[model samples]
Target: MASVTYDRTSCVYPGAERPAVDELDLQVEDGEFLVLVGPSGCGKSTSLRMLAGLEDVTEGRILIGDRDVTGVPPKDRDIAMVFQNYALYPHMTVADNMGFALKIAGLNKSEISSRVHEAATLLDLEPYLDRKPKALSGGQRQRVAMGRAIVRQPQVFCMDEPLSNLDAKLRVQTRTQIAQLQRRLGVTTVYVTHDQVEAMTMGDRVCVLKDGLLMQVGKPRELYDRPSNVFVAGFIGSPAMNLFTLPVVDGGVAFGDVVHPVARDVLGRAGNSSVVLGVRPEDLELAEHGPAVEVDVVEELGADAYVYGRTKLGDGEHQITARVDGRRPPGKGEVLHVAPRAGHVHLFDVGTGERLGG
Candidate 1:
């Protein structure tokens, strides 16, 4: 296992007006599972490709365990990559596929067989050792791809959306398996995906990126609880946080008829008559007198329900979402009053979209 470092690393493709991965600086601890996540065209994949030595570092250096490898070739980087499509050779049996790297490295047949069997057992693919890739299910093929990397014992693992090919249910199951497998192997891993839930659940620390720039890196809960900006506030959560610009009045921002109190410093930082207020769906409650909203839809999820509504705040209408008890959700078109829980509101500068305070 080894630590990886990106020292102001950057990648600019030919003729591109801007860098695909801008001067990114990140440190991955030994044996840590770090996930790079963002929307499509956000440079997450380009960053991963840079680490794998597939893309050139245009402005800075990358280090693996104190060794500067910015100019190293892909095969010489001592890293294993699991592609999104599970690039397995169709004609090769599972055992052969897993041990192919070792065979190429000139390891004897006996040693390669031993290593292949060990990885298969760890991945629960021992029964399918003789089967070809065409005979395996998507999930099974993914595991075979994983076993291929495991058998090599590479210093770092680079997995680029390895679960994108699986069904939803299998994707969830395989993510759990991969997380556990990474923990057991203790290999430094960098995973790239567009799914925030997968990043939150599988990574020891998640890195959020946008437009080739790093947004924030933190534990899943930290990112969800205290986003650094409005973009992050709306991007990290399921159903997302409801954000709307409201007039600042009496040291607070208006929420319909009521003024929600905010820190004086936060209000001062706004430097404007209005500020954006963000509230998570689960952090809101039905109140007798609060923001009046016309319900558009209610999604009932067994123990909890989310109410999507539109409310006229200030001079314009804005959409709002709130979580309510699942047992009794208000009917469509029903008017409901909801308020964000005290001390749970997020304040952002309307002009800059930056967070004001905690």
Candidate 2:
């Protein structure tokens, strides 16, 4: 396996004012599973396509290990891609589909057969080797796609939202399988998806991007615990972080009648009269007295529940979300006091959105 690098690489579609993938510089260590995540219209997929040689680089270079492969053909890049649609041949059996790459590369029938069987066994698709794509379940078809990638034994694997077609339960299951299999094979892999939860669970490191620019790159917990900016703070969590641009007061920012305390040194760095305060849903808890929140909806999810409500913070009312015990959630229209847990608040510059303080 080889490490992958994007050295200030960029891609611009003709006639477009801005680049699809702006200058991106990233390093994926050998055998590392790196995930690129962002919202729709973000450049995650374009960056992947540039590496796969399907898109032209308007500037800079891409490297696989020590080799510069910016202009290399896709077939010569020593990479395999698993697309979201499970691009399998309708007429081909699972075995043939898995071995097709080997056969095309001029491997003998015996070699191709051996490799196919090995991959199928690893993916638990041996029983369906003779079955066509149409006969397989969605998860089974995905396995076949994976088996096809595995048999090639490429230096790097590129998967573009490979599990998007599956149902929610199967998506979770297949992602686990894929992560385990990637670890077992020890091949460098780069995966692209719009799902932050999937990226958090599957990737060794995740790259968050927006509008062709890299936002943050870190281990899942790092990004979750210490986001670099407001965008990341708001995006990385399942129930997105609640952000309020409130007036900076003597002790802290104003949250209606309450004050969410902040270190003087932290507020000093804001450079503005107001600061953006972020708090995750889990960080906000029902308290005896804090900001009064009128509960609007409660989403009960067995062990936990999310309470979405409106509260007065600063000069106006705004929405807030809090995670509470599912069995004891407050009903709609119920007024409850919700406060940010100690040391759980995130502060950012009101204008620039950059993080402030430790």
Error of model 2, residue 150, in angstroms: 0.2
Write candidate 2's Cα lDDT for 1-358 as tens digits.
8999999999999999898888999999999999999998789999998999989999999999999999999999999999889899999999999999899999999999999999988999999999999999999999999999999999999999999999999999999999999999999999999999999999999999999999999999999999999999989988899998889999887766678888999999988999998999999877887889999999999999999999988768899999999889889999999888889889999889999953
TM-score of each model, in listed order: 0.98, 0.97
User: Model 2 off-target regions past 4 Å?
Assistant: none
Q: What lDDT does the true structure give each of the candidates?
A: 0.93, 0.93
**Candidate 2, position 262, lDDT:** 89
Residue pairs clashing, model 2: none
Candidate 2, lDDT over the whole model: 0.93
Model 1 lowest lDDT segment of ten? 349-358
Regions of model 1 farther than 4 Å from truth: none
lDDT of 1 by residue, 111-197 (tens): 999999999999999999999999999999999999999999999999999999999999999999999999999999999999999
